[model samples]
Target: MTPQWLTSIQTPLASAFYKRCGSKEKAKADERVAVIRDNSQQIVASLRLRRIGGHWLLRALLVDPQRRQQGIALQLLQFVGAQNPEPIWCFPYPHLQSLYHQADYQLVAEAPEPILTAYNVYLNRQPLLLMCCNR
Candidate 1:
């Protein structure tokens, strides 16, 4: 789902992300999709999606670090989950498992293959668990 707010902010975010990643190669990649929550004031949280397995995949989910445990993350997940209409898969930080599980997602034993990326390397190349939610 192409979010209107994300569509508005995408160019700048892509520019910043390309600079941080140091690569135009991945910046222009069509697979990346950004979803945001805003109330005509500020963005609450944002989730990124990438296509895999002929279905939409949840690639990144970030809540404002300052706004933890206020249901912001789950709200973002729920909103994005509703828009996509396909099973959503996630690779959440291990500590966030219980929280996501409570949101009707099931933890899985292995990471999905198509999502292996440099971000995983930064996360120590550990087996990032998978979780899926169908709504």
Candidate 2:
């Protein structure tokens, strides 16, 4: 089921995600979607799924500050994983490795060229985990 706010979330999603990631530059040029709370008419979370080098690169998952720790991000990850059973890759911050692992994403040592290039540019100096969901 597609969220009703999917079409209108690009700007707000980028804003919220950039705020959390501490880099407005990281939110550029990706296809994104949001999870909206039907009862409250608010977007609870957002994520980007970009096709890079024939693989789905799941990136920039962000939950509303007040909505963190409520399993919203995991739900979004699971939903996307279910929808795209093909290999899905992501570079998650070290702190989020366990969360992604709980969603069935495993650490990957290698990735496609586009993904590897992006990782080298964005996270090579950091302790981010490169993960993938192939189930």
Alpha-carbon deviation at 85 in model 1, angstroms: 1.2
lDDT by residue (tens digit), candidate 1, 1-135: 123234533635644543443434232246454534445534445556667656566655665565567887776666666667767666667788877787667865454465444235535765665455443
Candidate 2, lDDT over the whole model: 0.68
List where candidate 2 sits over 4 angstroms from the true fold. Answer: 1-5, 8-30, 125-127
Q: What is the TM-score of each candidate against the true structure?
A: 0.63, 0.75
For each candidate, how many residue pairs have backbone atoms clashing (under 3 Å)?
A: 0, 0
In candidate 1, position 113 carries an lDDT of 63
Report the lDDT tens digits of candidate 2 across residue range 1-135: 234225443556555555664545344444645454535565566777777777777766777677789888888887877777688888887788888899888888777788788778766566555555544
Q: RMSD to native for every prediction?
A: 5.4, 3.5
